[model samples]
Target: MSTYQYWQVKFEHPDEDEEELKAVIQGLFNYYEAEYGVRRLTSQVRDYYRLIGKQAPNHKRVQRLMHEMGLKCTKYNRRVRKYDSSKGPNGKKGKNKLNRRFMSDRKYQKMVCDITELKAGNGKKVYLEIIKDLATKQVLTWAIGQHTVFCK
Candidate 1:
């Protein structure tokens, strides 16, 4: 299927009024509240509009128009820790060379190091910095802090 049907939604030349569209959206929300006894965890209000014989606009368009009309959703602050794909395919990875190779003809010729984050407590974040020599496998330097913002 096309990402957006790959075709513009053609209206009847003269479309529904702005106020009417807002009213339809509001009516759907009211219906959802009444029938569902509060919005469901994964509720998309506009879905009800289509079920009730109303053409629901695209989600992005609904979001934009609703925001312009001072009607916005209270987004839940929920997130699941995502896998860091830049760290390569799963398993333990040292670091991304980007181009430079890790192999060397002689010992102590090159070194590789990496840094990672560890979030702790309720809000106060901690930062850890480490530097190590790949040739010797020796940790050269390390540092930790409450905030880990890097300088531009």
Candidate 2:
């Protein structure tokens, strides 16, 4: 069956005023009063009902109403930590061979190498290794592999 029909069957008789609740939800999201998602918005709506001495609506109903109105919280859901300090210092750490000099008078005299991973649409990651000439600003050579471990 359709999702709308399922929800309708589940909530045959809703408790709260759906129109008013939609307005409250939209106001909460549009005004940026607080970081709100489904769970937080549900509690805030319940608090509003409590303050008005009326019965609060169920969270599922609120969620359904919010979905219908296309009101959503745009807050970030995850935190990304860039650096990891757990690994021990390896002996392979090398010094700055270029000595902060990026320019080169001759072609291929100075080059920079970098490796990065690209995610494909088939859920597989492809690693690429690129060598670029610093003086000419051109890519010299490149290699792509499914599982290329450039750093030990």
- Best lDDT among the predictions, by candidate number: 2
The residue ranges of model 1 lying beyond 4 angstroms of the native Cα positions read: 1-100, 105-109, 149-152
Q: What is the model-wide C-alpha lDDT for candidate 1?
A: 0.52
Clashes of 2: 0
What is the Cα-based lDDT of residue 145 in candidate 1?
A: 67
Global lDDT of each candidate: 0.52, 0.74
TM-score of each: 0.33, 0.42
lDDT per residue for candidate 1 within 1-152, as digits (tens), equals 56455344423232465566666556655655433312341145456656777665666655555566555333333454533323543566545553666556555566544445676786444666566665676777777765433210
Determine which window of 10 residues in candidate 2 has minimal summed lDDT: 80-89
